[model samples]
Target: MSIRAAYIEKMKLQLDELNTTMDELQSKAGTTKIELQEKYLKEMASLREQSQGALDRLDELKTSGEDSWKSMVMETEKVRDAFVKSFHYFKSQL
Candidate 1:
């Protein structure tokens, strides 16, 4: 397969893994005190938005041509990085 196809596949898997991590974190968050749970929920909402943005970028990347796919890859990486960073920060708070 072409490098572009390979890169897209890797990103899709990364996003899937990120979703699973979020689910696990949410499960842990559920047992926190009500006050902290509210805060974690707000942060999780932001993480969800970032995850959705990454998914949206992935969809665009899938449809892009060879010439445009490189740029899409860069853009998608930015979104994915932000999501991962946010998740790490949230996890640290727990």
Candidate 2:
């Protein structure tokens, strides 16, 4: 497979993992105190937005030609890293 294809596959896997983590987080939130639940919900909503942005970036990368794919990869990485960090922070709070 070409480098672009491999990169796209890796990104898809990352996104899947992030989604799973998010689901777990949501499940844990159910047991949180009612007052805190509102805060957690807002944070989770932001994380979901970040995840969607990464997916959108991946879609762009898939259609981009060789020269432009690299840039998209960089932007996607930023979004992915931010989401991961936010997930960890939320988990820590619980």
Candidate 3:
């Protein structure tokens, strides 16, 4: 499958794992002491970091694709101009 599809699948899996972890954490929070609660918060922060990293990567990839498309359009315009100029020159020679 395409790279995009694969990336989406991976993100879905990560989301599922994060949800499960959060649920388990909430259940365990009932019995957790103050220190353990603090630790759980820290762990939750870490999980958030992971999700943020994935989102950042996705944004980067999207930006990269946009840049590539812009470059292609610029190059295509240049080629089209050159072709038009060449055609005009040939017509003028007739």
Candidate 4:
């Protein structure tokens, strides 16, 4: 695969794994106290939005032509990095 294709595949896989981890975290939150649960749910919603934003960026990169892929890659990385950093922070609280 070309560099663009390889990058897209890697991002897609990583995002899929992140989604799964989110689901597991949500499930585990069920046992938390009511007050903490509310906070956890709100954070999960924000994380989901960030995850969606990353997916949107990845889609934009995927649809871009070879010429535009260079630029799209940077935007994609920013979105993905933001989502990942947020996820790790949230996970650390758990």
lDDT by residue for model 3 (43-83), tens: 55655555555445444444556447455434434443443
Residue 84 local lDDT, model 2 = 80
Most accurate candidate by TM-score: 4
- Model 1 misplaced regions, further than 4 Å: none
Which candidate, 1 or 2, would have the higher TM-score against the true structure?
Answer: 1
**What value of lDDT does candidate 4 attain over all alpha carbons?**
0.94
Residue-level lDDT tens digits of model 1 in 11-82: 999999989999988888879999999998999999999999999999999999889877878888998998
Q: Would you list the clashing residue pairs of candidate 2?
A: none
- Please identify model 4 stretches exceeding 4 Å from their true place: none
lDDT-best of 2 and 4: 4
Local distance difference test, each candidate: 0.89, 0.86, 0.53, 0.94
Top-down lDDT ranking: 4, 1, 2, 3
Residue 93's lDDT within candidate 4 is 93
Residue 58's lDDT within candidate 2 is 86
Q: Estimate each model's TM-score.
A: 0.93, 0.90, 0.47, 0.97
